[model samples]
Target: MVDFTFNAKEQEIIREIRREGLVLRKYARYYDEHEEELPPDEFPEAKEFAHIDKMAADRGADATSPTAFYMCMLMHRTWGDMMRMKVPFTALGNASVTAAGTDEQKKRWAKTRLSMANTEPGCGSDSKAIETTAELDGDEWVLNGEKIFVTTGIRAEGSVIWATIDKSAGRGGIKAFVVMKGTPGFELVKKEKKMGIRSSDTAAFVLKNCRVPKENLLGMDPTVKKGGGGFKGLMKTFNLTRPGVAAMGIGNIMACQEFVAEEMAKEGVAVDYEAGQHKRSAIQQKMIELEAELEAATLCTLRAGWLADKGKPNNLEASVSKQKGGDISRRGAQLALEILGAMGSTHDQLVEKWFRDARITDIYEGTGEIQRLVIARELLNYTSKDLT
Candidate 1:
């Protein structure tokens, strides 16, 4: 029942997309080196490919698997370059809003690209410790907080800011609100200097008595429910994106392998599958191991994405894929550099950049430790409190 390969229509579209991706790959290094400058919203070459989507009108139902194919495409994107070429890149907040927002809130901000504002100066891995506060006053909700490491923070039309309505209520008091960028009392503090993914903007913000209509509250109800309130409802958005983060790792993995393999090929080294270990050189042995790891991690990602497409719970699977993808890509890039030696670290090649870029895929969606904890709790049927 599981098909690993895409249908023919999907295949056709993927090929064309990759064809264009190769063109963008030319600018990867340019953006990587100039981390301070955000990639242009639209490349001048975009005009040539403007009709790419409409060209897919005749695709069959076999190509309709959205989440699964999307994972495949994410890998393809990273394979081309870590610096993305898409204009007006989609924001992480958009997914959260779709998952937890009131129907009216969704309709109101249908076109707004929203970045997620969850991390605070003090809060990184443990989202439950968020210090941002939200209070309802008359027709508006007053929000006061500082957000850091906000992805797409500079380019997002708005942000889905998370704040606790009552810290005493614990996680139950946390909720999300839609705050437009130009809203009074909302200030862009500064952009972050990063080791990788520089083309994508990361920024910080300060909200001092920032007020938005009370209706902008996601999920509409702010009374700290018996549980962590709307906190769990908002966190559920990661069920799909965790696999997405893994897919990014998969892309880097594929790139790392290909780069090393090509370098080996130039030196007249071809990987021989049938050879015994004793006959294989040390480099050949490592190549085989890297290939095996890449295959395993990719399978884990595909399974997680497929589960999402089926409307099934993928919490355990998502964490598994995320950890696998994160670990492999990080290691693979390092191994690739080791194989290439001095030339690898030099800006002459991209392996060094991959080493830097591959790091975040694991850390952001959730740390490796968090993923392992999720896996443990799921296996033991333990709630958060029980596991902690």
Candidate 2:
């Protein structure tokens, strides 16, 4: 039941995604150097990639699980750039909407690109400590807050803003609302200059007495439960995305591995599968080790998916996969650069850019340290850590 292999159809689809991703790869450095420019909504070369969701892949009884298949799809999609695609991806909040939004809420914004406004100037990992507030007046809810480091904030037609209705109620008071771009007081304040992934826009927004119909509220429930049930439901979206983030790193490193292998081949450093350690060069051994490490992380990602497909909770495993992914991607990219020496550091090669990109894998979605804490708490059976 925990098999790590992809079926024929699943493998074919993933291969297609990676092949199409090459078009995006060609532009990775152009946008990396030109951080102010956002990638086009669609690349003429890889237009078919934008419709990959429409591909009909019928798996036989031996097909891969839905969760695993989705992870692979996301993984290969980012084989070129971390989050950049030939097409702009629907913001992550879309996943939150699909998971926690009410039926009417889902229908209302089925195709809207909705950014997530969660992190604030003072809050990053501690989401519950958000200072944003939501006050109801009449049939509208007034919002006041500043959300920073929003991905795709500039391009999203709207955003899902998080504000606490009753700060004292803690997590239960935190709620999600759909706020359109031209809302009375919602404004895009900043488009951050990030260290990497410059192809995608990371924005900051300020909401001043912004009001939307109360029905815009996700879950459409105002009663704040003591256990923060509604808030937890939205957080589950992270469990789904953490591994996805990891898979992106995995996909990137796979590209790195290919690049490195090709470079080595050019230098007559051919990798011999049958060669013993005594016969192989140190760099060759390192390449093999990197492959093993990548394989290990890849398996962790699939395991998280496997757990989900089995209808089991994967909170702990998600963190494990993400931690492994972030670690290896950072390590793998750095090692690739080191092996290439000065050329690796030059803009002439994407390996240097990937090295910069690898740093973020550990920082976003949840830091590698936070993931460790999650794993520690799960193993010890301790109560949830006080993230607030």
Mind giving the per-residue lDDT tens digits that candidate 2 earns over 207-246?
9989899998898988786888888988887888899889
lDDT of each: 0.85, 0.84
Model 2: residues >4 Å from true position, as ranges?
A: 48-52, 272-280, 385-388
TM-score of each: 0.96, 0.93
Using alpha carbons, what is the TM-score of model 1? 0.96
Task: Provide the RMSD of all predictions against the true structure, rounded to 1 decimal.
Answer: 1.6, 2.1
True-vs-predicted CA distance for residue 143, candidate 2, Å? 0.7
Give the local distance difference test score of model 1: 0.85
Best by TM-score: 1
**Residue range 114-166, candidate 1, lDDT tens digits:** 99999999987788889999999999999999999999999899999999999
Q: Stretches of candidate 1 above 4 Å error?
A: 55-58
